[model samples]
Target chain A: MKRWIPVVLVYIALIAWLLFSVFPFSTTLLIALKPKNAFMKFPPDYFSMKLTFENFKIVLSDKNWIKYYTDTIIIATLSAALSVLVGSLAAYSFARYEFRSKEFLMVFILALQMIPAASVIIPIYSMFATMNLLDTFLILILVDSVSSIPLIIWLMRGYFSTIPKELEEAAFIDGCSGMKAFWAVTFPLAAPGIAASAIYAFVRAFNDYIMARTLAGDRVVTYTVGLTMFTNQYEGVDLTLVSAAAFTALIPILIMFAIFHKHFIIGLTGGALKD
Target chain B: MKKRKWIPILLIVPALALLIFVMMFPLGWAFVTGLKSMTLLDLMTGGGRFTGLKNYFKIFRDRLFYNSLRNSLIFVSISVIGQVFFGFLIALALKNKFVRFKSFFRGIFLLPWIASSVIVGYSWIYILDANLGFLPTLASVSPFLQMLGLNRKDWLTNPSIVIYVMSVINIWKGMPFSMLMQSAGLQSIPDTLYEAARVDGAGAWQRLTKITIPLMTPFILINLIMTTMITFNVYDVILVMTSGGPNHASEVLSLYVYNTGFTMGELGYASALSIILLLVNLLVTILYFMILRYRERRLA
Candidate 1:
């Protein structure tokens, strides 16, 4: 009975806490769905207010909205794929083979994760402009890929380290060349890890604002870049319209996270927490 | 089967090339640019006058830079503490098997972590707006808020408490992540240790303080490093929320850099300030690793 009391108390507290945590997300949805009139009313009735998708309709109807989503999608997909392709092989190399300056190289790469894009925006902009690479899909993709590689490398390295050495030994004993053995056996086994890395890369690239703001232009703007233009108006911020745009921009990543929820946990934890 | 000498180097080159082009080269260029007077036009023209360390001297003397640095340290410290405290509680609560729908709860908690900062900024702004804000709505309904005079309070606009408000929002945004990390750490603790403590007449509080805290130190270190860095570098929230206004009350280092570079058009000065930001981050990373290595040595 005493133990049951503690458990019940904990549960109640947790329920309240969880509600508090998710209230903002709920606010986003509610505000996003409300028409402009509801927003204008003094002391806006957040709940039981009439809901409408007029905001979404307006946002979706914009010509740049389609460009925004497609550009973001293209950059995100390439960044994830390129990071996985480049990062995993590096991970395998770090896990399996050791060479000169390996320690130095690993440290250098990890330190790169701490360098914010804003810190180097001046130079990157100059260089990109020099090559006519600014506002291009390739520039955005390359930036995203470069930024994502360090974390993905660490994650894939952790995953590679966990796979038992004996599996690779078995393949080697079966007369498989090193590359063949990796491609045929180890690669298949690392699919979950690859998925996790890809998801992380996708999320990281998708959420980037600094890179997009600096490097992107009128034609190459990502959704997040476009979302900020809502508040940049001369008169005042249109909260309802901005909320809708923000929520609309959030939908794809939310769906991605929902579909790969378990992998997100595994990937994130595996990267940082795995022994 | 063959451990080729060149294989590892080959694997590293392609990633290295892209990384150098996008990250390393630009950082190096930033250092050079910081030594000169640069403008938007000078971006491609290489026309900035070479004025060695003049930008660094000016930025160091700027009052806005000082306020931003001070604000960043204060905000980051509060954020790390608040998030970790709440996160530990949430992780402990969720780890209990008696909690039903654990996975559902986990997914819900991930919302703040995975959502774009731009959206989060907007969502918070919608809720915290002084006129039609959720708080004021509660205030209009509940006498408790009126007692404290929180009715229609300008949370983002009030410069004095604005830092605290920003800290709270960032703490909420970062809590789910530390919760996730702490949950992983809590699960990895073997049940036998707790059972042994129980056999020794340890209370729940005693067991947590004596056993759990000691073992959870490593994950807590990781949490500290991550939350500190992210909180320090937070830009978009302040960018959207208050634009670091009514004055420069809420401006952190990252936002200050953007304002100085773009809004004020002082790229060289911004570069110098960011170099300091990088130095601070490097110090923190070094500090975390040193503590970890010390712990390892002690254990051995």
Candidate 2:
């Protein structure tokens, strides 16, 4: 009985948490299917009468959404790729090299992570405006890639450090150059870490709004910014339209998680645990 | 081996170059901008004169600056505390041996962390809308409470309650990260310690107090620091829900800096405010590291 009591409590607590976390999403889903008038009903219509595709149809038909989705995908993919490429090299360096200021550089990179983008958004905006790079996908990709470099470097460094030095030494002795040896031997071993970092970089770039809003303005709006338009116009707060948009925005992430669930979990937990 | 020494440096150059261009350059530019007299036109056109410390002085004189700082501190403290405590409790409960379906529960609990902040803000807005919301429904269900004359309040619009509402939303969004961290920490603790305490006839409460809390200190501290830093820097939710309106009651330091620079066109003064925020974050990070080092030494 004593042992079972704690078990029951834990189950109860978990159920409560699940309800809290999932209720809003389910509510949004329900509201999306409801008729326009059903949104504000006092008794709260749990189910929709004559399920309508109007909200989804309207959201999909919007001209700007295609551009927004395209821009988001482009930025997220390019940033993730760039972050992984640069971060892998830097991580390899940190793993193998015994240089002066190595620890300092690593800590400096960590400190850089602490600097909020909001604190620097103005300066970045001004800089981009001068350079005429505002509203360019290049700016979004560049900012996200740099912001994600530290974690990628750290995670890759952790993964690379665990690989035996003997493998690299053997490859070098067998006539492979240092770079070639790393590419052939160490890179494959660290693929999981690289994959993890890529997902993170992609997600960060995909989900980021502050930087996107500041840098791109309306010209290169991401899906997040596109979603914001639903609210800013404020025509009686179309719950159904907003819900459909929210769900649309969430689908890609959910799909990514589904496809790369193992890598995502490994990457996130691995990075946190190592820290 | 000798040739290989520079290879790492060569490999690291791209990342370093990108960082310097994106992060370091803007950081230096911000400081320089803060030291200059720059209008929005001047900033946009790259034609501004240096006027040292004047913006800093003006920022100090601004009443909104101090109010933002105070509100930020209060919001961060309360939200961080709530998140960490609840997260720890939930983690502890989940870590118990008898807990069933742990992975399913954890995944569900983690939904908030992954959900977009904009969506969470919007959902809460729907939930708290005074005219038509679930809370009003719940309130109406209890006639005794309705008879007690409790008026429904528009939580987001009220200045006094806006900060608290924001804090609740922040906590809801943030607690999952802390929960994951605490659960990970719990995994590292050895089961034998708990078993030995049980064998000693120690009650369940004693076993938990003696074995669990001390072991979880590092994770708790880490979560505290991270959450505090994050809460202080929060913006997306505030921007979505309130936009620092109703007399700017929910204006945090970061948001204040944003509004000053972008909305009001006070570029120089905004830069000063940004610097102040940087200093505060630096202080918090230093304090955390100091405590961590002290604890490490004592443990060693």
Candidate 3:
């Protein structure tokens, strides 16, 4: 009972923290599930309000929303694939080579991770505009891939460095060429890292509002951008529709995070702070 | 071995070139474009003339730019403090051996982090609204709160507290990442160190301050730097939540640049502003690399 005291205290604290953490999510979810006409009341009046799934139904029913959803899925998938492909190629070179200017290159790539998308959005838009690529899905994809690559490559390098050189050495001895040895032996070993980075890239791209809205605009509205349409035409925000649409935009990534929190957390910390 | 020197170069060149084309080229172009007078209409036709430091001078003279830079600094400082403090507490609590279902708690705590900034801003708009909102509703019911003036938080509208409110929101959103980082740091501290401290008759507070904290400095530094950078560049939440309204009370540098470039059609001026921000980011990154180098040397 004496030892149990501290454990019980820990549980109490944990529960209190969790309630605070869960408040926004639960309230938002409650609002989303509420009937369209039901106004938010003090005490929340859950029993009195007519609860319904109509908001979610409305969100899904619109073809515009479907296009937004499809656009996000396409962009996220392709960008994740691109980040992994580009990241792995560079990461492998960094891991395997003892080349000149390696340290300089490493630092340069790592520094690229901190370039906030806002800073580059102007030039990126201008460059793409010059090529008549603005508002296209391709531009969003390119921007997303570039933004995701720096971190992915760094994480991939960390993963590659962990696998012993002897595996590739053994492959080489078995008559495999350098590229073949890497593909046959080393690449498969880095699959978890690849998956983690891909998920990270996907989440970043999917959740993006600034880049998606700025570059793609009305031509390729992502879910994040589409959901913004719920705003008041004049005041520029509508809580009722926003609650529904925000909930819709949130589910896929939330589910993904719930399932892969371990990989996500590890990959994030490993790539960032670990030397 | 000498012949294979170019092999690595070949392998990396495509990726490096792609990155430069997509990432660095835009930055360089933005810098060059900053020297020119460009707008949305002239974007494709190349109609803007070279104006040297005219755009830069204009941004420097702008009051909004100064306010934004100041706001960014304040927001970053406030957020860095709040996130680090709350995050360290959460991490310490979670690190307790008595704490059960650690991962479950971690997942719950990460709700703010997992949600997109837009979703976060959207949710907060309702939560902090003067009417039909949580805080105001709570204030209405609580007599003590009403007596103490503890309720009715004007989270988005009030210029005085808007930036602080934004800081708190980011602190909540950013705390989870720092918590995880702190946990990693805690785990890396060998148990033997704690056992030795215990043998020497150290109390819980002493152990925390003397052993746990000192050992966790690197992680703490990382968290501080990362959260600072992230908070400084906050645009989406502010854009969606307040649009930097209430007389531009909460406009950060990113929002200023974004509005200027995208909305105001002052691309050249926006580029100059962003370039300033970019230089800040680069300077900080260099400092971080130096710190990392020093830490590595000490550890080795």
Candidate 4:
């Protein structure tokens, strides 16, 4: 009876979580298919008397969406690639080398994670405006990469530290240069960790709003900022259209998670707890 | 090892340079901007004069600033505590052997966190919408509650309760992370420890208290600190949900800073607030490290 109590509680909690999480997604899907007038009924009809694909078609065919989606994809991909390359190198250095200010640098990098993006948004905006790079994809990529570097480094550093030094030492003994050893031996072994860090950087870049909103403005809107267009303060909000856009935005992330589930899980949770 | 000296330096240079140029420089610039008496025109045209601590003093005198800070602290505290408590409970349940389809449950549970905060905010807005919301409908439908004749509450409209509404959304989104960390911590403990306790006739509660709690301390501390930082820094959810509305009752520190700099065009005052947030985060980090060290020494 005592054991059964905990089991019952687990089921109860799972049901509660399901209602909270899945219910929203289902409601969103339902809303996306409903006619605009049906969305505002007094009882708020869940089922559309006549389902329509008009919202989806509109969102998909919009010219601005094409540019927004392309800009987001480019930014996410570039930031992920740059963060992985730079972060892996720095992680390897921290793992393999004993140098002056090593601890200080490590701590400093960790502390960088604490700096709120909001705090720097104004200065970053002004600085970018001065450089004439505001609203450029390059600025978005640079901002995303900078923000993601610390996380990638932390993950890579933790994973690299776990790998034995002797493997690289063996490569060095075989007349491989230090760079060659890292590339041929250490890096390949740390591929899983690298993949994990890359995916993380990608997700962060994709989901980020403040920097993208501040830097890109309307010129290079990301998926997050694009969704904001549906919300105007004084206008009548079409919940159906907004829901459709949100559902569409989630597809890429869900697909990415599906493709790299194991690596993503290990990378994210391992980095969080271990470090 | 001779070439190694420069190789490591070379490896670190690009990341360091990018970080400094993109992140660190802007932060430094914000500090400098805070010390200047710059109007938006002056800042835009590069004709600002120096004004030391004047913006900072102005923020202190502004009542909205204190309200934002207070709301931020309250929101963070409630969200963090709720996530951690529920997370611990979920972790305990997952550790049980009888739980079916564990991996499927874990994946679905993480949906709230993985979904964008803007999406979550909008979703909750639907769930809490006054005329067409689910919660009010459900509340009105319950036979037990209907018998009591309690009125359906307008959760979003009330300034005093909006933070709690926001907190619920945050906890739902964030609790999965703490659960994942705790589960990982749980996996690290050897089964033999539990076996020995069982052989010694210790009850399940005793084993949980004596073994699991102690082993999970490090993970709990890490999750707590990270959650606090996240809650404090959050803006997207608040932006989408309330935009610090109902007379700025739900306005958080970060959102306040954003508005000050961008909306009000008070660059200097916003910079000061940003600096304060940075210092607060730094202090929190230091405090966490100190506690960790103290725990390590006590254990030793």
Candidate 5:
């Protein structure tokens, strides 16, 4: 009985923290599942068993919502691919060779990573507006991809460093040119790191609200921006729709996280903490 | 190590060029824009005249600038401390031999961190809205909640405590990153140290303080700095929740910059505010690095 005290206490603490973490999600899920007008009722019926999929169905069938999602997918996917490709080249440069200003350049990139998006947002907005690039997928893609490059470079540099240089040398001996040796040998070996970096960039672009909002408009609405559109002035009328829309945006990312949690953590910490 | 000097440079040119176009050029333009007397309309017409140091001087006198600065300080400090503290506690708790299903607990804990700030903001709104909030709804029935004073309706609207509330939600959303960081730090500490401490009859608290905390200082400092920088820039949740309203009580520096630029059309002043923000970020970063260096020197 005495020994069980500590175990019980630990369980209680864990359960309490767990509840704190999960309560909001459960409540939101509940509200999202409620019938459209049910949430407006006094003393909401959260415990009621009258669940419905009407909200999800409505949101899914809406062409605007569908467009927002597809836009997000395209931008996120392309941004991820572009950042990884470009960032890996830089990462490979850092990993494979010692050059002049290498240390300075690496530190410079790290410092660049710390520049707040909000700080430069005004200039970015003006730059795009001046170039007539605002409201275009190309601008969002370029901006979002650039935002993730520094961290991805650092993360991928770490990955590239771990792969043996001997592998590339062996490929060199087998008549592979420098770039071919990289493509044939080191690239395959660094696939996991590339995947991790790509996903990191994808999530960053997908979750970017401020950048997407500032640079994008009607034709290029990401889900984050679209989620805000559901927030009409008449709060309750769109509350269910907003909730449903928000949840719909959440599912794919949640699924992605669940599938690649290890990569997600590595990416989230910017490779600062590796398991 | 390079036969051709240009090979590495060639490899790096694409990334460097993109960064220059996307990041560096914008930053340079921000400085130029900061010096001008411009608005959103001026931006379109390219008509702002240079007014050197005027916008900078104005920020020093702007009451709202000072207000947002104060709010940002409060928001960043509280969020950082709460996140690191709660994260460390949870990491330690999960490290215990008695804790089971560790990964399951960790995954659930990370949900808030993974979800978009917009979603997180709306979810919390649903939970805290004055009329239809989950807490108020639950409070109507539960005597325990009412006793605990969790029945308040102005959780998002009350100016006085709104910043603090935002800090709490920020903690919920951010603690997992610190947890993962601290967990990695914890793992790096050899188990033999704990075993030796136990052999010496040192209790749990002493073992933690003497062994764990001492070795974990560097990790904690890094965690602190990272969280500080991240939280300083975090206005997304705030944007979605209150839009820095209920009389601008919750507007941090980043959000204030956004509001000033886009909402009020004060593009020039906002550009100046952004430079100030960039300085604040740099100041905090340099301060932490100095502390880090000083600590390393002492340890050495």
Candidate 6:
């Protein structure tokens, strides 16, 4: 009985935390489900059963909404692929080589991760503006990929370190060049890290608000920026529609997270403190 | 290890070049811009006069600067403490022997962290808005909630407590990272130590104090500094939720920098403000490292 008491208490606490975690999302969902004018009622009838798919249908059918999705997906995919390709090369070098300033370079890269997006927003905006690169896909891809590289390098480096160097050495002895040996021997072993880093970069780019908002405009509107457009259009009156749009934007990310959460956790934790 | 002396450099060149072009160069440019008296018009006309140290001096005297500094301090401290505390609690609870379906619970906890800030912000606004909010609506019919002071409508507007409210929401979003970190830390601690403690007649509380906290200190410290640095720069959620409204109640330093540059078109001053933000980040980082090293030396 004594043991059961504490166990039950713990379960209650867990359930409470679960409720707290889920409330905002579930409520947002409820708001999204309500009929167009239903939410405008005095005090807003949150428990109303007058739910409809009209909001989701409307948001999904919009042409601009579709464009935002495509833009976000394109930018995110390109940045992910670019960061992983670049970061893995750096990571491999850090993993396999003993070079001068190696420690300094490693620390420098890690410190780069600490640079906040807000700090460089102005300068980056100006630099790209000067190049006539503002609102271009290339600029967003490059900037987003650059932001993710330092962490990806750290993550992929950790993975590369775990693989045996002897495999590459043996490949070298078997008449393979250094680059070929790497691709043939060490690269496949580091696939998990690459996937993690790619997904990390993808999610970072996809979820990016400030960078995309400041740098990109009508030509390169991301879903996040697009959602802001919905809010602006409705002026907070048709929140049901806005909620619907917001929920729609969340779906892809939530789905991705549900599928790759383990990788996400590993990448987040690994990139932070592990040497 | 003998291949070619330049092989590693060759491999690293792409990433290095990207970093230099995208990050380091902009950082240096930001410094230069901060040294000038530039506006958006000046940026177009290419006519910013050199005003070395003038913007920095202006920042020191600006009332908004001091207000934002105070707000950032409160926001970061509350967020860091709340996140670490709740994260530690949840991680500890989940680590208990009776916990089941651990991965499922963890996945749910991570949902908030993964969602875009725009989604988070709008969802929260609807949930907390004074007139149309779910809580205030719920509070209307429930006397119990009224007794608990949950009836207040200005959760996001009131100048005095808006920063605190934002801090709480931030803690909600960020605790998962800390939980993951603390979970990794907990796993690093072997189970045999607990067995040994039990054999020595140590109760749960004693074991926690002696074994868990002391062992978890380094992880906690790292979590603290990381969350601090992150929270200091996390203006996105605030930007989406309030935009530092109702007389600049929740204008954090980073948000202030952004507003100065973008909204007010004071590019040079904003760059200067950002430099100050960077300095604050560096200061916190150095302070934490000193504490970490001091702990390590004592242990040695």
Write candidate 5's Cα lDDT for A1-275 as tens digits. Answer: 47778777778877888999988878878887888778667766677788889989999998988999999999999999999999999999999998898898888888888788889999999988999999999999999999999988988999999999999999899899988999999999898788889889999899988888888967899999998887763466757778888888998998998899888888878776667
DockQ order, best first, reads 5, 6, 4, 1, 2, 3
DockQ of all candidate complexes: 0.62, 0.60, 0.58, 0.62, 0.75, 0.71
True contacts kept of each: 0.62, 0.55, 0.62, 0.60, 0.72, 0.69
Give model 3's docking category. Answer: medium
| Model 5 Cα shift for residue A223 (angstroms) | 0.9
Report residue A179 deviation for candidate 6 (angstroms).
2.9
At residue B253, give the lDDT of candidate 3.
Answer: 88
- lDDT by residue for model 1 over B160-221, one digit each (tens)? 88988899988888888898889878979999999999999999889889999989988888
In candidate 3, stretches whose alpha carbon ends up further than 4 angstroms from where it belongs are A1-9, A40-49, A232-238, A271-275, B144-150, B286-300
Residue A13, candidate 1: C-alpha displacement in angstroms: 3.0
- Misplaced by over 4 Å in model 1 are A45-48, A164-178, A231-238, A273-275, B1-3, B297-300
Residue lDDT tens for model 6, A87-196: 99999999989998889888888777777878988999988888889999999999999989998898899899999988888999999997798889888888878878
RMSD of each: 2.4, 2.4, 2.8, 2.6, 1.5, 1.7
Clashing residue pairs, backbone N/CA/C < 3 A, model 1? none
DockQ of 1: 0.62
lDDT of 4 by residue, A1-275 (tens): 57788688778887777677687777777778888876566767663368899989988887776677788888999999999999988988998788888898888887676787877888888888878898888998998998889888888888899899999899999999977988898888898899988888888888887788777856788878877776652135588788888888887788888788767776667465432
Better by DockQ, candidate 6 or 5: 5
Over 4 Å off in model 5, which ranges? Answer: B1-3
User: How far does residue B285 in candidate 6 sit from its true spot (Å)?
Assistant: 1.3
Cα error, candidate 4, residue A140 (Å): 1.4
lDDT of 2 by residue, B232-259 (tens): 8888889887888779899989999999
